[model samples]
Target chain A: EADIYQTPRYLVIGTGKKITLECSQTMGHDKMYWYQQDPGMELHLIHYSYGVNSTEKGDLSSESTVSRIRTEHFPLTLESARPSHTSQYLCASSASTGGTEAFFGQGTRLTVV
Target chain B: QQPVQSPQAVILREGEDAVINCSSSKALYSVHWYRQKHGEAPVFLMILLKGGEQKGHDKISASFNEKKQQSSLYLTASQLSYSGTYFCGTASYGNNRLAFGKGNQVVVIP
Candidate 1:
């Protein structure tokens, strides 16, 4: 089984506060992804990384940013929280950036009030 | 672009079969399937590459129609454990970015 993990299973914060969601994987996969999902909705990719020292914005145009200083760690940060940013943030890893199956972390549910 | 998933929701009993479809407008080279239960992250089920390839994981199988830029997931002998939301992800030619469909919520009863 894939050994991906996300910290802070749930978070509720005040508006304008800065928050960071942590993601880590033990499988040493080369590709990592971050997605934001709302209830009963499809997941929206906010950011993804090809490998260490590489990060790219996704199609959703999220206000959050990500960093990939290490291959096993990818974290998403929101500078200023808003109600709109309240959603489930998921992290995943795959062998490659293209055609491989991705293993997901448990996910972090953030609620910005 | 995001793919489109048909039958947004489905209900079935154990041992029944169901099909979930994913269609994309762009030329697809890969299709991925995932299942997520309530309050959990999605788990990858399988991946289907171009050239009309079919893959199976236990009783869960899927097919990719490269020519039509579509894919279908087949759940055979559905178990209550299969109850969850199914999502289909697609990657078009020359693109590494993955996009997902609206998702199909499936409920398998005893």
Candidate 2:
């Protein structure tokens, strides 16, 4: 089984509330990524990190921000959640190798009402 | 840039075969395939590097054509367990991040 894990499997929060989604992996991977997807839609890359203290925005724009302070921990936070932010957030980690497979977490389903 | 996938959706009966194609305009360094069931995270299926090699896992296999910047996933003798959304992610030279295609939905019926 993959060692990556995401907390709050499901979350329903009111608009304007601040929320944080947690992601951690024990696999000692140097690359971590976050993706957003709507129900039955394509996965859009939002944020990714090459290592601790190195984060980059993906092709897709997102209101959320992520911090990578520890190699095993990468967390995303939404300052003011909105209905438009409702989507499933997936966290994945992969080895530094170029062609290695990425291990994904269970994903956090967020709903902003 | 995200790759383009053909045949947005396909349905097949058990023991049948199908192919899903993914193509990119940019030169590719590697191709990754993943399968995701309803309400679940995508599971890695396989990875093909620039050598144009073919990799197989169980009855499912995939081939990468570096020259044409395309990849194809093959499902042989489809099983009900094979029903899911398949996504192909492509990585270009000098880049480790993968840009994924829209995805192809495959349904297998018994």
lDDT of 1 by residue, B1-110 (tens): 89999989999999999998999999987899999998877888998886589999989999998988899999999999999999998888776678888899999999
For candidate 1, the docking band is medium
Off by over 4 Å in 2: none
Local accuracy of candidate 2 as per-residue lDDT tens digits, B3-95: 999899999999999999999999888899999999999999999986689999999999998899999999999999999999998888876
- TM-score per candidate: 0.94, 0.98
Alpha-carbon lDDT of model 1: 0.90
lDDT of each: 0.90, 0.93
Residues A2-82, candidate 2: write the lDDT tens digits: 999999999999999999999999999999999999999898989999899999898899999999999999999999999
Off by over 4 Å in 1: none
Instruction: Extract clashing residue pairs from model 2.
Output: none
